[model samples]
Target chain A: AQSVTQPDIHITVSEGASLELRCNYSYGATPYLFWYVQSPGQGLQLLLKYFSGDTLVQGIKGFEAEFKRSQSSFNLRKPSVHWSDAAEYFCAVGPSGGTYKYIFGTGTRLKVLA
Target chain B: DAMVIQNPRYQVTQFGKPVTLSCSQTLNHNVMYWYQQKSSQAPKLLFHYYDKDFNNEADTPDNFQSRRPNTSFCFLDIRSPGLGDAAMYLCATSRDQGGYTFGSGTRLTVV
Candidate 1:
């Protein structure tokens, strides 16, 4: 079965610091990976996705992720964190060609401090 | 201005009472999905409608039901909602293109 894993449950980073959230996926074939962010009391918003082509994908809100096929990883990164970036991040994976159902990771909560 | 819209942003219901949550989309996408998200947990897919076809997840409770009356409207019905059912219910829509557009979500609270 296809699944996603987010190792960190919670992470705290000071404002202006860099951020990295790790994600790993298990699938038998090429995967369609995605990163989504959810603010408190709000629905999830898509940050980025990697379907095919370039490994590095850029997304909204200055977020970027790199898809490593060898490691089955799609790690979300932000060079400089802001107070507004504090939210829960989820990594999802779907089959390259099949059902559109997405398997999501447990999610990582990012706490930004000044 | 196309987006997914969920009604009753915050819903409060008595335990064991049935309640309905609604979702509508202006994107006119072929697929609409419902997800249940508990506190600090990943969102779980309850079901989805590809056009008029309803697809339910295997582990979804029988108390939870969905209806897609039209391409633009979808409803989630909870029969005898329990305290455990208090969580955020999200609605999303997508086309053949990758990535889904999610609504603001309905926060369901069973008292």
Candidate 2:
């Protein structure tokens, strides 16, 4: 079974500070990884995805993630945090092939302090 | 713009009452998914429709049902909603399986 894990349940960072949220996936092969953000009472918005080729992927809202094959990790990073950046982040992974069902990780909630 | 749309942004229903949530997409995607998200928890996949075939997760209870009449519409029906059913229900669309485009979810509140 494919699974994604987000170790952090909650993270607090001051405004203008750098941020990184860890995501690890367990799968037989190299799976497609994604980062999504959701505000309270709102639907999820895609931040970035890693299919193949590049190890580093850039996404909307100045977010970026690196896919490290050795570590089995794809951690989301932001150069600088903003007050409005507070939200829940989820990491999802799909099989490299076969059925397209996706597995979602328990999300990490970020609280930004100004 | 092309997107997945879920109706009734917020719904308040009495316990044991049946309620239906609707989802429609302009994305023309082959896959439509229903996810139940409790507060401060990950979204749990209830089921999905791939074109015309219905795929239900093994852990999904019999009380939860889904319908996809056409390529662009899907509905989730709760036969008897309990207080535990109060949560946000998300509808998503995908071309294949790489990723999904989600709609602003419907918050179901069973009182």
Candidate 3:
């Protein structure tokens, strides 16, 4: 079964500082990777996805992620964080070949400090 | 914009009472899914409707039922509300391999 692991449960970052959130996935074949953000009392918003490409993917809200096949990691990063960026982030893995089912990680709660 | 919409941002029900949460979509996606998310936990898949076919997860309680009358609407029915069943119910839709479009979700409270 495919699964996603986000080792960090909580992360605090100062505003305007660089940020990185680690994610690791387990899948048999090439996995469909995705990053989603959920604000308090809001639905998830897709941040970015890695289907097949140059390994580096950019997303909305000035975020980016790199898919490392060898490490089975797709970590999200931002050069400069903002206070509004504080939210819960989830990493998900799905099977290719048209399977829409996704296995999501527990999620990482980000706290942006001023 | 094409989106998924869930009604009643919050709902409160007494123990053993029946409650229904509704979801509708304008995206015309072929798949609709229901997920239960407890506090500080990831969303768990409860069931889904692929066009007209219904698929339920093995661990889903029998007390939970769902109805998808047409491509545009889906309803989740909880036969008997329990404290453990109190959680945020999320509805999502997708077309084939496309990314999912999720609704704001309905937060259920069982008293």
Model 2 alpha-carbon drift over 4 Å, by segment:
none
Backbone clash pairs for candidate 3 read none
After the best TM-score superposition of candidate 1, give how far the Cα of residue B29 lies from its true spot, in angstroms: 1.0
What's the true lDDT of residue B7 in model 2?
Answer: 94
> In order, what fnat does every candidate score?
0.81, 0.84, 0.62
lDDT, candidate 1, A1-114, per-residue tens: 678899999999999999999999889988888999999999999999999999999999999999998998999999999999999999988842377688889999999999
DockQ leader: 2
Off by over 4 Å in 3: A96-98
Query: Sorted on lDDT, highest at the top, how do the candidates line up?
Result: 2, 1, 3
DockQ for every model comes to 0.78, 0.87, 0.76
Q: Write the per-residue lDDT of candidate 3 for residues A1-114, one digit (tens) a residue.
A: 577899999999999999999999988988888999999988899999999968999999999999999999999999999999999999988853245678889999999999
Task: Give the interface RMSD of each candidate.
Answer: 1.3, 0.8, 0.9
lDDT of 1 by residue, B1-111 (tens): 998999999999999999999999999899999999999999999998888888898899999999999999999999999999999999999885467889999999999
lDDT of 2 by residue, A1-114 (tens): 678899999999999999999999999998999999999999999999999998999999999999999999999999999999999999999843377678899999999998
Higher-TM-score candidate among 1 and 2?
2
lDDT scores in order: 0.93, 0.94, 0.92
Chain B TM-score list for all models:
0.97, 0.98, 0.98
**Candidate 3 accuracy as TM-score:** 0.97
